[model samples]
Target: MTQRLRQCPRCGTLTPAGECCGAVLQRAKPWRMTKQLVRNLHIFAMSRKGLDAETYRLQLERVGVTTSKDLRRDAYMALMRNLRALPDSPRWKPRGKGRAVA
Candidate 1:
């Protein structure tokens, strides 16, 4: 006997086992992947400023952080804190006597 496919509640379409309906699942949602990307970007930016992952991880552990999630969270928070502490924005400007026009 053949197993019947299940109907998706959101789109009323048939879906196989362990699959999701296309209409019900959005393709542009960024919440799932953005966090890791943001974390890596932050790490890369920090590295450009002379801070490496091992050093950052040691600093976090010195203050009682101990897991991958905690490390990423702390790194994100630290990056935000450093960014907020900057006196000027990190945008490019023309190399001349004229002031930067935003």
Candidate 2:
């Protein structure tokens, strides 16, 4: 939603709607995914992709992250792409709603 600038009647100062007296108003920024959640997603993908412990460690090493818990958002994205591009690993499929795991 676009914030409408409202002019203060007495002071002639413009500010965002619902606020006055020269108070600065800023839009709220969307929060990034939490690191713990990222770790869970990475681990789940690895398990579904049939990656072994050694391979998991090797992949993290390639990304310069010693552990999944230490990975930043960008690194997680890069690692996810790398995981998807693995030639030999079985592709991980997302389970649909109401579908049972095989």
Top-lDDT candidate index = 2
lDDT of 1 by residue, 2-49 (tens): 555665657656655434654443232212326676576454434333
Predicted structure 1: clash tally: 0
Note the Cα lDDT for every prediction shown. 0.48, 0.66
Q: Show how many residue pairs clash in every candidate, following the order shown.
A: 0, 0
Residues 1-102 of candidate 2: C-alpha lDDT, one tens digit per residue:
866666665566666665556554443333355767766765565656667778888888887888777777677788888887875335444553544334
Q: lDDT at 101 for candidate 2? A: 30
lDDT of 2: 0.66
Candidate 1 Cα errors over 4 Å, as ranges: 1-38, 71-79, 82-102
Error of 1 at 22 (Å): 31
Cα RMSD of predicted structure 2: 10.5
Residue 84, model 1: Cα distance from true site in angstroms: 7.0
